[model samples]
Target: MSTTRPQLPDDRPEQGGSGVDDGAGPAAAVGRRTRRLTLVGASGVVPMARDFAREALREWGWTPAEGADRKAAAEDVLLVVSELVTNACLHAEGPEEVLVSTDGKTLRIEVSDLGSGEPAPRTPHRAGRPGGHGMFIVQRLSIDWGVLRVPGVPGKRVWAEVAAPA
Candidate 1:
């Protein structure tokens, strides 16, 4: 199988940087569009998937004013990705896809699996269970999250968005 890094938009302007014209048009006013990074499957590619997300954040121009904030954000993104991917791999069947995107203020992570099963978040008191804590952690960390049911597809997409640190 081919391992390819997804393409990111080249002309998307930075929001707070100088030389960025506010009157550049509606599209430019929106600033840089979030790029999608996809991983075909969870097996054997988890580490690479995490690294890809971190690199994408850097490439999208999210730099920390001080030490390690950028790294922390990247790590947070990676952890969320790992949790979603692991849940899909463990509970679902067939190929899986992971997509990560950022819109300057928030980072969105999505994992698609071929299995039709929906992951329900268990209550905190029941969190001591051997498994089933993935969605719970996701709920606690993400600003908002949900599932998307794609017609004609055997499975669904579970997505989460975390607010970007100031």
Candidate 2:
């Protein structure tokens, strides 16, 4: 027997710096279900980050989901996670942390890195192009995405938000 879970509310983003006690830290699930994974000095950061996000989604009850829409939504969240982490690995001197969270209505993925480069969808987006498509993929899958310059820090946090299924 399965019980229906209430829809999540559209809550505000979580606050604070991009610090995590590696991937073994405690996760907070009070208001926002969030998991912060440290990828610095970790090998295979991208896959590890995605796996972390997947676990978070499962813990948040986003997976083992019913219906096609909900499943697709979950998949989109993971793909965006992969893209963001991959971008950090390829261009941002590797990611320092990957943060995954949700407030019942929207799922958010954030990747923090020390690279000073700003991320944006390539202008005159060429779908035929082989490289430089990470941000573009992010832009397409996510309802909204942006970069936040970590205050007093030499890095930026790239975040993307995807709407939760009703």
Candidate 3:
């Protein structure tokens, strides 16, 4: 599959964890950046998702910082991306596009696919199972996440929002 990172709006603030202030502004109220990726198929979508997230994090200043928060944020982003993309690849035909956006305080991830079935976290919590923890992980890590059906469209968009590093 092909992965592409388009240029986001320049007005959005860049999220850097150094807290050294690169003159971007206060981290609390930083602007937003949204990156969209169009995937051709399921093959290698996991790595593609990770790469897309990594590039966005670097651009947003999620580099290694003094505190663990920065690292945690980066890891969370990667994990969330992997989980969501993997879910799409496994359950649906494949992901059509993945959108990752951040407003310094929170990171929002959305995976759109050509599937109508809604994704739900498995009930009863099968921790010992070979799999089925993807949505569970997404639920635990994200502040909020859910599936959205596009009006008059054939597919749905699964999305999650996680708090950025402190």
Tell me the whole-model lDDT of each prediction, alpha carbons only.
Answer: 0.61, 0.77, 0.73
Q: Write the per-residue lDDT of candidate 1 for residues 1-166, one digit (tens) a residue.
A: 1111122233222233221122344343455344344445335656765666666666666643245766666667778877887787788763256655665788877676777777767665385568778877777778877776646657777777777877
lDDT per residue for candidate 2 within 100-152, as digits (tens), equals: 77768888887888988878778898888798888888888888887776356
**Candidate 3 structure, TM-score to reference:** 0.79
TM-score of each: 0.69, 0.82, 0.79
Question: What are the clashing pairs of model 3?
Answer: none
Tens-digit lDDT track for model 3 on 9-75? Answer: 3324233232123233543344656677778644688898889878888878886544887788788
User: Which residue pairs clash in candidate 1?
Assistant: none
Q: Which candidate has the top score in lDDT?
A: 2
Residue 20 lDDT (model 2): 39
lDDT, residue 160, model 2: 86
Q: Compare the candidates by TM-score and give the number of the best one.
A: 2
- Score residue 52 of candidate 1 by CA lDDT: 61
Better of 2 and 3 by lDDT: 2
After superposition, which runs of candidate 3 have C-alpha atoms over 4 Å from their true positions? 1-30
